[model samples]
Target chain A: MLGLSQQALLRLPWRRSLESIALPVIALTAALIIFGGFCAMAGANPFQVYGSIYKAAFGRWSAWQHTLILSAPLMLTALCTALPARLGLVIIGNEGALVMGGLAAMATGLGLGITLPPLMVQLAMAAAGMAAGGLWIMLAGALRYYRGVNETISSLLLNYIAIAIMNHLVEGPMRDASFVIKPSSAELDPANWLGAIPGSRIHFGLLYGLVVCLLAYVLIQRTPFGFAARIVGGNIRAARIAGLPVGKLTLAICFLGGSAAGLAGMVEVAAVQKRINQSLVSNYGYAGILVAFVSRHNPLATILAAILLGGILASGGILQRSHNLPDATVLVFQGIVFLCVLYSESLYGKFPCFREGEG
Target chain B: MAAESLGLWGIPLGILAGTLRGSAPFLFVSLGECLTEKSGKINLGLEGVLLMGAMSAYGVSYLSQDLVGDFWAPWLGVLAAGFSGMALGTIHGWVAQQPRVNDVATGIAMITLGSGLAFFFGKPFIQPQAPQLMTFDWGAWSSSPQVQAALKVSPLFLLGVAIAPLLYAFFRSTRWGLSIRAVGDSPQAARAMGISIFKVRLFSIMAGSFLAGIGGACLSLYYPGVWTERISSGQGLMAVALVIFAQWNPIQCLWASLLFGGAQAIGPTFQSVGIDSYYYLFNAAPYILTLIIMIITCSPQRTLSGSPGALGKSDHT
Candidate 1:
């Protein structure tokens, strides 16, 4: 069983929060063992691989910065999944939103005639990106509310459509025309670009993602709308009986989730890539789902999960370069950890220690 | 000149060919999912099963060096895929039956696992071409270019078509199929009648995944002899949509797969015709059609009722 119930966790003092961390600690240990087996299968030394991964992901300050850079988008993308999940709406359109957001941010950069200050351009890009993403998800939510379509399938279809649209635009209309091999839009001005953290390749996006996560946590856990959404997710019949505005709330939360991911997209464009390309999707949206699942939909826990997974992702290039392991080696490890973490859910209410008097 | 370029004759012919080639994988995967769903368990992991099937089939055929052609390669690949599917399904059934693990979440995870493994193995096959299956040259009967193109159906297409009536007959007449359906319709009722709901559902998921694996294998061996990471991109997931579009019937699966195939083929058709706008529209067609079909079929009046009772019966739904 998971160690602490909602009521118990709330009632416990700050000292008991340490006990709650036990689940993830145990889960992380289990993950290492499983990944060790995978390393054996791949004909690599497990200890050596582990050592290399640690060195590449966090042993150096630069590696840790890169890890945070990767973690930035994942954090917001986690919200894109986690928020709607609170309302029992599986709106998996974050990647699509991210694409749209990137397009919007790129377009803003291209279309803006006046040379504004860096802060103003960044703010405008974020707003535009979030709007594009928010609008895209709003359509899905609207269709689910009014037209009775399944959001999961529609959102997924929208992702393909968005990717195709991105491809078409970059290849045909918005293409810079000079770059023959890899078509991309005109790069944003370096003056307008986001600055990196002091002495790190990491940008301010990590701070932004963490702030969004904190805000999402408060919105989902403390706000009235969050309370109503939970009730709706639990039971629509009960929610309707309780006079909750289910349809509007669904649309609103979905929009907020989309905006979070859209912001991540803008940050990627402004901070990391500085150009919108097909590489916008490095499976961050998909990986975010695993992060959300491992965190059990709690926004704050997603930070740790995303950072942990980000470390693995950061080390993937190192593993591929050093051991000649396939880049997908990281994928296998993530898959193993994801499956084990999910399976560990069975332990939640079953543990004798968590039983009435045992703890 | 416009009329000649239009090649109106090519439209129907291409649709027919598209239906056969495109629908083969859909047909196979849907029939498998149909069986699984009939037993009251929906396994979304078929997408991964299909990917693994493609990888294994392609890997084996490439290693075999085409001495025997790729004819038997997919069959062998399907077997491996089926074995993998059964293994994954067993885990799904076990965890789901535990009353703690969520089937949908578990399925999503298994999908990632299957795809990860497929890409790991499929990395070796990015450039080298596997031995392709020999075409029967059925176009010998037709002089027209369009007709010839339409006539060249893969043997897997024929195999998938053949599976339709066989599955229909099995569902209508066979004891196991009927028991599976009974368990799906009402596990509680089936349990009352002394049936093992867990056992039936387990068998259903395994069988469903096996068929999906064959469908995946067909993509690599017959259609295009090369494998890529994106080869099975949305085919597996789209097949899930096809099951709903087919109304959970094996015969309907054929029609549904063909329709999906036609929609998919339109993108290439636009390129061949040199219609730039059509290219964009055509690319968007399948997803739009699928979304429309889902909305229409799932409408209040036409709501599907014969699906496995447990399908989508989540706490939220």
Candidate 2:
């Protein structure tokens, strides 16, 4: 028999990946148990509360529809984070871009004063939104490339600026004076409105988000651009030595990421809210970070993670109403899961058998 | 109108008031960050610390119903918030101290966790009628309402002012402070000199968190007197940026915070005057300015030379 250290080093590769996946699963289940205890403390039956949460989030047809609706924007916004992350750029400006995109869509729809078909209007809106977001993020990338400013702080700062800009437009110039309590842009005319999915609250936006995710997966996994981005992310000096257009790659990904997030704003305005408003943020940008983290920044994994998180978000309203659980409980769970997952990063590359045991 | 608002005259008065309101939180967060950075680690988790402070301070003030009578409430709430930061910071320090876990990742996780926990406890305190803390009326000298409004200095403002010079002195002149600074600048050198870098960083993060917690308390207890989901509103993050803008000098930090505060106040001032357009740009002015400043100052080949060498150094190897 092998010694204890040798045995510990002899774990299978499949087992390692399983453990990588299992850690989060275990953390989530443990969270449920802890939250269940919290539910019990708050004078609710844990079993019943959990049952209701599951039913409201994913068990029923209507709930599934809500899940899809929520997942659509999350998937796109998560791409805003994931794509930039591949280039080692921590761009948290997705919310800001989303707001700008929605504003762009609203401005274009109203400014042109043309009555177009729904699909045509959506296409136009998407293009407008994408362009706005693209420019916003490219500013950060440009600053980083040319000026040596840290992208994380600059991107985050830009996000604040973008939101402020949106708020100004909605509250000042672009506001439809007819509405009060919450300022908003003029509602998109009915001809420009996006249709709902056949069976539920799901919309054309979900399909768009999925297509983007698929496209991102293909781009990252297949393209020469993807290869260059990966090399740059792994090492900047090496990437430059390899004769790669490091600055161009960084700028392109940032633009693409920002556009994806901007599309979220576009879809929300055209297909869901039907107007540009302050509700554009709704912490979707922040939630997208959690979705990206849970998926470990993999584009394909982000889609699944978004669906899971969307379910939790959809269930939050139900939990608050039914079990007296605070709506922020979902946020708390996300925080815990995120922390646990990060802590579990220690597990990666630790097994000697998985590695070649080379120093 | 732009010319009327221009020159050193208009901006300074607005900046003074802004400094008073804005400096309180900056004083606490930067001081806390100073301490943490001195310990040779960074805690971007101050955002969560501020939120928790706001929630707990509001809850405490609401529970007591007398602002000054329950002056201890905010302190207690601050302590609670500090402990929360310490707990999270400790986990961060421990994990980062390990061979594998990245400091940036640890900080990000802590931020997420701290904010989540704050939101969780902050739920009940959202609607509480918080007792407002007393304000010092430095504006009483002015006859003009505009001048009066511009000069209404807060007690917390004065406190922040007093704290900056004191902290600057403490970090530069004191023995323990030197030790903290030594560890921050070079852990290898510190270890050679027999100082524990780990202990120094641990101490600094805890202290920085305490100050950040007090900043949060000031927001809820003194100025705003209410709690909401957006209570902190990235103030904690901006203050960290402000640290860089200040070139990591406490005195410079005082000026930077005031500049931001004035910029913040400009939006409301313009709104009050009914100059309706470009309000978004006005609101965004500070962040944009910050980005511009960051770009102008940060060198392409080398990092900012003025920073304490130990700040934000990743133990990646």
Candidate 3:
């Protein structure tokens, strides 16, 4: 009976779309319940933990500021995964691209110094960052298309190399010398720092994220280029048969993804951190991959996913303070949610809810 | 025991020691990955498996000691680590077998799940002491304590070494192994022959994860011999790259593991000599070496030449 129903479910059209919307909601609810169980096992009241998390994440205007601030980098870094995923590529080197972009941005900002106008210097920094990150990720794409190396492995390896290069520079050639306790590069001029949005504590980086995500959505969903990209992603053979530039599309999409991550790094440095240091290696890039996945690789949906994850991250400290939970409690929750999302993708079309004669 | 006695010669000696110690995790993890990839699946969550294994082994060793004796405690810890890895493997394998599931993405999700579970449970045990594995005294003939110490090999390493040849023979001579190979190389052909691709692939995956868990045990129980959150610095992840470089050959995994171990030892060896200037650069040796290996060995012309025909981007695994 179950197998017959599954076959019938596959024959329906609107049922598929309905499943996509319903499945994720059900999956997220299941994940929340599982997380509550885990919290209980860890000796905390699940309800209290959930309450604290809610209060910390979205309770007040000030709390929203923290969530939005954290969401900025996530929105950008998530693009690094979401964009390439559209081209049927799995690139997880957002961390590497971000690191290289930040490093390049730092060099460009420091190289220009106070010689140029602050706005111009910041613009140059953004360009350099995007270029570095783009090229960095593009290398993985090139390797995949040209050499047949697995993009996932190559990208992950690049992450370590980028971090290594950052560490070398910060400890050696670019060391600021003032920080005896920690290794870091020279700070950018305060005049050149990214300012907050009008009447709010949120930085301009948040605007950059929203605009970029919007542009990316339009680029992938509306533009002819996006159509071409989807064609290449949907079927490489059909793409080749249609005389589409599969290799170029693959490389370009990868470049765009990397540039998004790189911009996140630049935003982190210029907006939040005034200097390049060990603090820049925060797992924003890794977390962004989760955002991309939870959003099902949709650039626009990434906005919501990033905010969701950002709220979880913001609640980390609150959970720790109120529930005496470990800081890793947030990670546990994120991981549970991610697993649930992935598992839910498997259940599509399994449940047949066909309106009578509407099939 | 004196540092001066091993001077000048100490670098190579230290490298030998490091290679013996560090290579165990690499060997076990790669061998496990080799087994999975041989059946046309990849377990990228082995990093999480490794961490989970490390955390569980240390925790079990500490907790089980009061129930059992010291010797039994560490052994029980090893057993628990394998079972825990198998538990995760069950999840990954089940999800992987579902239609339209991307193995790469599932592997990534499994990684997050494994690490989160490990870290949440691993926090309390980080500060506690656990019993370590027994080591063999191969260097007993040498008068130098450093030489004797360097020669002490973990039994787990030998087990890995022994398993390499056995695994090679299994794939070469055993019926079940041949079935795994057929399923991995050509799922359609295997399906035509009435082989259940689902069962074979699931078994290979779970067994592979079991080995990876033991590799984690080799890490926390043997070499570093302690529980720390940062015990593994991507060894589980790198092992996958290592397996690719080894061309999925089980015997080749051993040599590649030693090479990886030497690369891992570069920074520590230099630091031992107080040459810590480029410490971070040298620390990236394994990743750099893996990338270089991939670039050199993995060209379109040669890709999957020795790999199971169905490996990477395939729906089956």
Question: Against the true structure, whose lDDT is highest?
Answer: 3
- Models ranked on TM-score: 3, 1, 2
Residues A1-359 of candidate 1: C-alpha lDDT, one tens digit per residue: 45558656555543344434666677678988988888888899999999998998889888888888889899988888888888887766778888888889878876762477778888899999899888888888887887767677678788778877887887777878786658677678887677887877778999899999999999989999899999998898899898999889989988998888888888888887787777887677777767777787899999998988889889878888888888878877777778778777766655545444344
Q: Which ranges in model 3 have alpha carbons more than 4 Å from their true place?
A: A1-18, A354-359, B1-5, B314-317
Model 2 regions more than 4 Å off: A1-13, A37-47, A112-114, A350-359, B1-18, B37-42, B64-116, B126-128, B139-153, B175-198, B308-314
Most accurate candidate by DockQ? 3
Candidate RMSDs in order = 3.8, 4.5, 3.9
Error of 1 at B112 (Å): 2.2
Candidate 1 chain A has its poorest 10 consecutive residues by lDDT at A11-20
Candidate 1 Cα misplacement greater than 4 A, ranges: A1-20, A113-115, B1-16, B64-74, B93-100, B143-150, B299-306, B315-317
Writing each residue's lDDT as its tens digit, candidate 3 over B172-240 gives 999999999998999989999999999999999999999999999998999899888789988888878
Candidate 3 at residue A114, lDDT? 92
Which candidate do you rate higher for TM-score, 1 or 3?
3
Worst-scoring 10-residue span by lDDT in model 1 chain B:
B1-10
lDDT of 2 by residue, A128-167 (tens): 9888887788888888888877776787787788888878
- Pairs with backbone N, CA or C atoms under 3 Å apart (clashes), candidate 1: A1-A347, A1-A348, A1-A349, A1-A351, A2-A348
Enumerate the chain B TM-scores of all models: 0.88, 0.86, 0.95
Enumerate the candidates' DockQ scores in order: 0.48, 0.54, 0.56
lDDT of 1 by residue, B19-105 (tens): 666777777888888887777666667777888878877777677655554666555555665676666667666655545455656
DockQ of 3: 0.56
